[model samples]
Target chain A: MTADAAVVVENAEKWFGLNPALANVSLRVHPGEFVALLGRNGAGKSTLLRVVARLVKPNRGRVRIWGVDVARDPERGRERIGLVAHQTYLYPGLTARENLRLHARLHRLEGAGERVAAALTEAGLNLSADRPVRGFSRGMQQRLAIARATLHGPELVLLDEPFTGLDLEAAELLSERLRQWAAAGRTIVMATHNLEQGLEGVTRWVLLDRGRIVTEWTGDSTAVRSRYRQFLKGAPPGAQGRRT
Target chain B: MKGLQKHLGLVALLAMMAALYAIFVLAPVELTMGVVQKIFYFHVSSAWVGFLAIYLVCFCSLRFLRNRDRQWDIRAAAAAEVGAVFLTLNLVSGPIWAKPVWGIWWTWDARLTTTFVLWLIYMGYLMLRRLVDSPEQRARLSAVVSIFGAVNALVVYMANRWWRTQHPQPVIAGGEDSGLHPDMLLALLVTVLAFTLLFFCLWKMGCDLERTRDSVESLRRTAQRHLREVR
Candidate 1:
């Protein structure tokens, strides 16, 4: 593991019973590298991101976050990671601000009140901070989830399908937040089916097909969508399956 | 390995049968309650096993929280299911025992009430798991509830000791003068041992069923994905 690498997944393989979700996948993410994982559904993009976040374990191999092996010391590994999964990971009964405070307490953040206040403002949820999250719109909930994930100021952030239910304006807000985090030297690995949207402003793009890295490209988002479409056309039928 | 499990299961069944014989034919009947006292052998044993199963749930829940492993969560859920089944048996049999002895099918005794509450809490725990869609969230929420339920178990166990009620004092731990006959104690011990073994067999079976269900679900997802790709 390199000292500068924020996340390292080496020869990782994970299986859900008979279905192989991740097969011999290895990747190293350095500090401030915004990696956009692009693939069709069931291409193992989410699984790979989950492995780096230590939310799921690999059947055979190791994942290291900032030079610390996750399997050996999961608590410490989790301390440095902030994950925004497909599920918002929020309590429906709690208000947006209350949910952030609970997350702050879990991460043992210092100056939790101030940090939560700032996170709410950053997510544009300050006005609705006291409203129960159950009453919030899907886009509002997604924004709150983003705020909750980044509340502890983690060094590495893993987002799985973060743009799934967002409107145009919410998407733009999230994009701005991602750019700001990247500028602050935080490593980000995002899995998204929105190829064109994901490629914008990302440092690198990796295409996964059937649990394997099929191709990689960096720089220029203008033609990336066409390249991704071409790659999908050439992939086997099973590799183009719907997401699990 | 499966053959070994089958053999062990058969052994447990045979041992249970032997315990029944010991309870009915070998052990002398109580002078006061006669045949109705027979239910005490299995009733007390099942209650012990039920409490043990819930404790196992608590232990597995704590482990799941510490490691965030799905295996631990599965174990905790299986234990809770088995625990709930045994607790149901205990509650039903208690009413059967109570109808003839106390002339009432139920009572608001401290011990009885607390045990019922404990059952409700765990049943709610299972319901909470069913309501949650995500596996991670379900595990986290259920773990917190299970820990609280385990703490409630302590209160249930001590209820009879703390308060006087219509419920009979504990036969095993009812102070110096309240000891059982040597022969009766031996019979109870054998029955308890049999029930503990039975609990383990049921728990293992439940765990196996859960694992198979998960595998089938995964396979179904894979098949669905394949069908979508072909379309």
Candidate 2:
């Protein structure tokens, strides 16, 4: 809840029936902090990111975005967050341009038409902007999703498994966009299973296991892959795996 | 708490049986409709519970939109499902009673038609949920539909007054001369109370089943992840 902290989760715990999805998880992100959240499948990566986005509330504890308590004032918290989830969150019947325009209008962006056009161009979707999103490939749809998430120019970006269906080239392009966003002082928390891809351009790395932050590294991506591998090996056999 | 739930279930069952006995044995048979009038007790009660369930869906949908909490979405879905069940009973029982009393199986009366439309809307809502793969999208779309259906429920309740129809006027609100007899009203009240309790029990069971289904899906995904890792 600090004034400078872009995102803060305090002692968050979430359970679905008998299964605990997130347990006593707490983390904080500051301005310009690009945190790459790495974990094996079912390690609570997506749940933690959702908690930050306020899409899912924790059974116990609180989350704050940009110094506003999410549980107390969800609308304000939502206004400051841009989330790119597993689904593209776009209408397939609408053209890419139309989709972005809808999001822009929903966010009450100034000069929505111009902002949407700029987003389409920035995402390299200008040429296919008029075509229905249903005709786009997975990679193209993902680029549009990224464009949509950033359309509002939100201060905190939360991405869950953004690279799940992307090609190497598309992923590289997205990484570059993320780097540019981070450079502009936006805080970002990304959840990914890709060890190597997640390390690129990230300022900090966190590894979660069984709903807890087991290890963290800052300032250098050189040894993160090896360290992550060793960490995964030491994790329980049930916890070390890729998402289906 | 578990013991309380079990006892509550038993109490609801016993009360339902008592309500049935009062409807069949205690309440006097209608001079005009004879034995077929017995359906009125449970039919009207089911319709009342059905409308109440849909209202709950609307309430939970609004809560879900405001908070974006999955629990509200779950509750909305469960309510809609239970509402559909009760609505189907109302619709089916209406036709049965009409066949014996009105000498016809069906009619496009104002109340009957609007109630059918309400049923269709909720059925469509359930189908829309099934068609959407993404959980967030499903919840958002269904919430919108639930809100619309709730507004439609008001229309259905008012349809008889707004238009001419063969359906009987409201017995409870039928003005000074139109109220039910004391015995019949007592029977209807008991049936309504029993059905309301039954609605809660079914709604709770539905929510529990949904939660269990979600947990099973998560476990299956985790197992699949483990299998992939082994390869």
Cα shift from native, residue B184, model 2 (Å): 3.6
- In candidate 1, what are the lDDT values of residues A1-244, reduced to their tens digit? 2667888888999763355778899898888899989888988998898787677777788998889999899999999988877689999999998999999998999999999999888788889999999999988998898888888889998888987877887788788888788888888999998764545568888988889887789877767778777776653544643443
lDDT of 1 by residue, B1-231 (tens): 677577767867877987887887778887766789788888888888888988899999999888667788889999899888888888999989878876788876666777788889878999999999867678888999999999988977687546754455533234212556666677787898888878778888888898898889888886885775566
Fnat of each prediction, in sequence: 0.26, 0.05
| Candidate models: Cα lDDT each | 0.82, 0.84
Q: How far is candidate 1 from the true structure (C-alpha RMSD, Å)?
A: 6.2
lDDT of 1 at A119: 85
Question: What's the true lDDT of residue A204 in model 1?
Answer: 88
Q: Pick the DockQ winner.
A: 1
Residue A159 lDDT in candidate 2: 86
Q: In angstroms, how far off is A36's CA in candidate 1? A: 1.8
Two-chain DockQ for each candidate model: 0.16, 0.11
What is the lDDT for A45 in model 1?
Answer: 95
Top model by TM-score, which number?
A: 1
Which of the CAPRI classes, incorrect, acceptable, medium or high, describes model 1?
Answer: incorrect
